[model samples]
Target: MDRRQLEYFLAIVQTGGFTSAGRRLRVAQPSLSQAIRALERDLGTPLFDRLGRGVGLTAAGEALVRPAKQVLRDFATARASVESVLGLTGGRLDIVALTTLAVDPLAALIGRFRAAHERVDVRVTDPELDNAVTGMVLEGDCELGLAESPGGVEGLDHLRLRDQEFFAVLPPGSAIDPAHPIEVAELAGWALVSTPEGTAMRTLVDRELGRCGAAPRVAVETTHRAAIVPLVLAGAGATVLPPRLAEDAAGRGAVVVPTTPRLVHGAVMMWRSGQLSPAARAFVELARLDETALPPAGTAGPTRSP
Candidate 1:
């Protein structure tokens, strides 16, 4: 009912128990307990039920969790708004990016943006590559999300920023030639560092290789772009990734091979339904820039970086 009571309940959920929550919030244990009890009394339902170890959320608790977080965020925003009436402050940018985007373009974009806007703070929320940005949209946490074309998110504003294509990254001394590119059949003999089966990348790679009546011999299965690049550079195997990722990996001495049926990647910038922040606008500008921050890509869509 009250902010204090809501805060108490949230503390309990986040820290996983009355005692731990009290410790985290720097509140006396007894006061934390009383506040939660008061909140339950106001709502006329138990928020949490005791399990063997700490505690677990009841259905009611689960339902209230997100709203509680939103309320807390709102309160913090309100306080910050009052302060900003006199002076401005830059808080964190809750962001999520797709796997392919996380490499050079995204990293370069972040570096450029942060360098310009030293007052702004940014936070990332990359989970599994596929749903990372969409999840941020659904949760209403991210201010802006950079993603591949996520098929099913609704009630959000989306803009296509740029496109990328996948390339074969070959190990040092690899027989695969950078100039010739690799054929669908050529992939079968090499160890592939692959995304999990059924992912967009995996499906594309598998389907392409299969069409040639071949399947890559997978050396390792991992979800991180950083991992794949290194394995290729180390001469362990080859992997497929977007152009930007390929370029970075190849800089460390791996060879990049163009593949049959060029793989395409898209970058989408999505925001929850609302007005834009000055910072968000600046980021949108940067995201639209060509892999290089110049020429036709900049002249075409979006505006200059702020």
Candidate 2:
């Protein structure tokens, strides 16, 4: 019936119950129930069927879901369009990204974006697991996201930034050949220090190893990307790293070897398929500019892994 009512309705639908929806919306449960009742009265039909533990959308409620979502998206887009005309004065941009990506292209893009629009404030949330980044975006906690492609969410759009190449991070002076790409089978022989289970790198490693019918002998597991290097340096085991990081580690005397089959994965910038706030749009534009002007991957000098 109204924007607030639509918001309450959608929240209930998404969260699957009135109590959780009320908690999420930060409103009293009674008030949330009243609002939904009001919405149902306006629609001339009950939107939800009460369940033993939760609620389910009735036929009418199901019908309202898609349009309600679109309406909310359109309203946000309209507000953003108005804000864009104001030239991004004191706008804020929220972003969620993977740790490894936050250290590279995302960091650079944020720097450039800030320089271009001094009034816009940017906040970045780096999650170790890739899905958390997508979750942040999907839940409307962030306006922008940078991570591996094929986010698998409907109504979101993304652009490929680059194919991030993964390299083997070996101990200092390891016998593994640096000049040639190491086969997955060969790398599996060494006990590996790996990023923890949920990270993109770990997923990549497991998928590749599984495809090869081999498994890594994981010696140590860590959540922090930086920790991988020190463990490897201490000869804990070899680990995989992205190109710039590998290059920097190599510069620091770590044996950086390319992987066999060239373990390259795509990184993308993703946003919902509606209007972005002026600041967010500006940041996206800066990212686009950076992508065009930047040389092919690995062309820029190595950035030392911190």
Please provide TM-scores, in order, for all candidate models, with all chains considered together. 0.81, 0.72
What does candidate 2's lDDT look like per residue over 1-306, in tens digits? 899999999899889999999999999999999999999999999999999779999999988876786677666657766877876667567899887788778888888888877887889988757877776676666778988868557878777787777888889878765666689777788889887787888888888888899987888987767787878888888887886677777777788777778777788889877777677778888888778887877544344322
By TM-score, the best candidate is: 1
lDDT of each: 0.71, 0.80
Q: Write the per-residue lDDT of candidate 1 for residues 1-306, one digit (tens) a residue.
A: 988888889889878898999888999999988888888898999999988669999999999987786676566556655655554357556678766666646787789888877777888776575665676565656667777665446767776765666777777777654666467678888888888874556766787788889877888887765677777777777777776666666677777777665655556778866655556656777776643444422122211011
User: Where does candidate 2 stray beyond 4 Å?
Assistant: 1-83, 298-306
Q: Which stretches of candidate 1 lie over 4 Å from their true place?
A: 76-88, 198-200, 207-215, 275-278, 285-306
Best candidate, lDDT: 2
C-alpha-based local distance difference test score of model 2: 0.80
